[model samples]
Target: MNERRRGPVLIELEDGPDTDARQGPAEAPREPGPSPADAPAIDDPDGPLPRPRTMEMVTRLIGRPPSRLTRIFINSGVALFAFLLSIAALDFLNGLLNSYPLLGWIGIALFAVFTLAALGMAWREYRAWARFARIDAIQRRAGSALAEGSLDQARQATRDLLAIYHKRPEMEWAAKRLAEHQAEAVDAQSLLTMAETELMAQLDQEARREIEAAARTVAAATALIPLALADVAAALAANLRMIRRMAEIYGGRAGAVGGWRLARTVMTHLVATGAVAAGDDLIHTVAGGGVLAKLSRRFGEGVVNGALTARVGIAAMEVCRPLPFIAQPRPKVGNLVTRGLRGLFD
Candidate 1:
């Protein structure tokens, strides 16, 4: 019988006495038995292979799954709406073009212009939206981080976010305004504190309080003068005989004379303050009556030239001089409303 040979067979022939002697069998011949790691077991029988979806399918899968024929419905709906809108727009355009067939040309020209305008506007809007989106996301994340008690993260987010806005001119301006307002408030508070401290240091507490109280009273009184003048003007507006005429209404001798006298008082205040007025400015005066008559004479003009002229100077004086002193302005709705409603009756 011919000897038979098996192809690469291995037998455990009891590890013949010298098995551990020379070295491991030629690089530890790859095991013929299944490996523990590679054993075909459990539910898996094959290796992984790629069957990636197409781009469009991937988009739908990651976002909204397509129902095979469903996209047609959406596209059809959009197309219908777009077609209707285009038809309406075409009709409107056709109407214009119908007037002058050349209007279609004009419209095309205008359309080009408007298209450019729309493009520019869209570009601007997209830029603004992009900026705002970045800002909003950063602020949102900053708020979340703050809430999570990671102050450093919140601050970093805030600074990074605001950095872009601070680069804008309008934002920079607004920030500057806010800083100025805060500085002014701080200065005002500091001055008030200093004033109080000074007063307390210079005078007994009661005396200081009294002085402050008296100062406030004087300010309050002064504040009433402008209002008083306004009331006087309001009182006269209805009764002035020449309410219509108004050319150089204050040129009347009486008004000029009156203005002179008032000017004198202003000069006196200047003098008291150790200042002086020019000779011409203090040249003349009204022989009789105070500011009321003079100013009354000023507005005292009604549809008449002399009356208007005579009263103009004093009236102007009364209105302008006292304004700086007044803090609270009186409401004028009553007289204004009455005048407005008069039209109804008319």
Candidate 2:
């Protein structure tokens, strides 16, 4: 057998007219295509618009007032339940007394304890409402004083403010300073402004800290929590706590029910003013225009939620503060967000 052609065979073919063997004019080296980082992002006709449904839902739930029918139903149900509960309790006590004397005595003691607790709670509720009333009265007086330039009314308002903050050791110096210089104020506006500058400056700082904390919590929850409605719940809770703190900072010292009421009031104000929704202007102002592109969807939502929370906190401050923001500038949502979320994203 012919030692099988072990060597490799080469075949040659003629090149077609289009197949240039020699490199022709080096096709003007295609300018290196833009890099992913440097290339302009393709503009989508339909942008990924942010939907802050969490804050929206929370605000709506808090802000919307109960309908008359709903209120009636709730009130009637509570009354009926209380009446039935009392009857049942009495029957239970009678049975226990007839059968087990010792248990009956124990039950009586428990009932007494419960009654005392209820009474105490009622008293606290009353006091909370009274405090709220006092704040409202102060606001009205301050507004009237400023409007009418009534120095007397201004002095009254200042006294009320001083009384509210009198127990706060941190406020002692501020109170003293106000008392000393308040007399120098010639008009109502001047007097109130002086009081605000002296007293509210510290309170304002504290309230801002509260707002920033709430914003941070809300942002973190929105960004990290994956469960449905969890972020909404967290945001609502944070706002409620923040509002309550705001009230306390401004000397409202709201109780449980009062705090909830104050939160509702703040939410109502926000909803009425259409501040619940975070717009592009707000996002750009707070986190800059590229935040959405640089961050994930959750992060973007977080930023928006945090900004809305700051807005709610500001509203709460306004509602809770006895004096209007006449002397001190109101806290801005952008500034609060920046401070609150400073290292969060980084």
Candidate 3:
């Protein structure tokens, strides 16, 4: 039964030999694939996420319904289709057209117009979706690649960025800037690879120098450690409890000062001392820090020690004559306070 009611018409087909049944709700007419909004619900009884539907198909497949504008176009199309069918169904049109003047061709013309309009609307939907699907695919791949942190991500991001580039007419400005950024990022990665290779090929003289220097500084600190510890231990003696506590503290301090085993402990202590930067792990703590930063504190300190040592060495040579000066005793705050309080008397 067909009638022109200026509204949507729904056709129902029941489960028979022609239609598969025994399932969930009535399946919407199977489109090419599921749309994102209608993507299948997936969970891990064991593991593994559900697969994603392409974005374009996502809406159509899942009834991830398109916009009202889309509805407008689609409804328009359906309306046009029905309009044409109505004219064709009207058998009186042939005779009416034969009898009437301009009126004769009117039905035929409406039929042609509505037919073309329906086709155009359907085509627009498909075209918009195909474009969106391609772009969405590239984006999904790009996101996955980046998250994977593989070199492949570099390739995918670049491609996705390019795909996004061509997607819009107004995107030329964004595309140009992004292209420059991608180029720079790719170049930087390449340089890092090459530099790493060269550093390795040389057998890591730099690593050797830093590690060796740390080993030496630890040794030197250990050598002086006994004297420093003894001084602290002597003052805390008499009180056995205090003596034990002081010994443990200084012992840990001395051991960790340069001991390879306690490198982390010592560095932690030093930074906490607030003599240097306020931080826990310097690399993570420092905003906008770079590769050299990735090294642990112990290693960084080793390199820094080398630089400082060089500076000290240069200064040592220029220190031929200490600035001639008379030794001034350190101010005695206790004595000063006593004298001041003794009353200003002859």
- What are the Cα lDDT values of the candidates? 0.35, 0.83, 0.35
For each of the candidates, the C-alpha root-mean-square deviation to the true structure, in angstroms, is 40.3, 10.3, 44.4
Worst 10 residues of 1 by lDDT: 243-252
Count of backbone collisions in candidate 2: 0
Q: Candidate 3 — which pairs collide?
A: 34-57, 35-57, 35-58, 35-59, 36-58, 38-62, 97-104
State model 2's lDDT.
0.83
lDDT (0-100) at residue 276 of candidate 2?
Answer: 56
TM-score of each: 0.23, 0.83, 0.29
TM-score of 2: 0.83
Question: Clash pairs of candidate 2?
Answer: none
Candidate with maximal lDDT: 2
lDDT tens digits, residue span 1-346, model 1: 9988779867555335456655455343455786699866675424222211121121122224357578789889989997897687678778888777787778767767877996777665555445434544654554455356554554455345335434555345543443344323223223222322322122222222222222222222222334544433332322121111110121111132233333333333334543222122221111111222244433212111111112222222222221111122221212222222233235
- Give the lDDT of residue 114 in candidate 1: 79
RMSD of 1: 40.3
Q: Candidate 2: where are CA atoms >4 Å away? A: 1-41, 44-46, 272-283, 286-290, 343-346
Ranking by TM-score: 2, 3, 1
For 127-202, candidate 3 gives per-residue lDDT tens digits of 5445434534544544454455565654554554445443455545544555545544444234223322322222
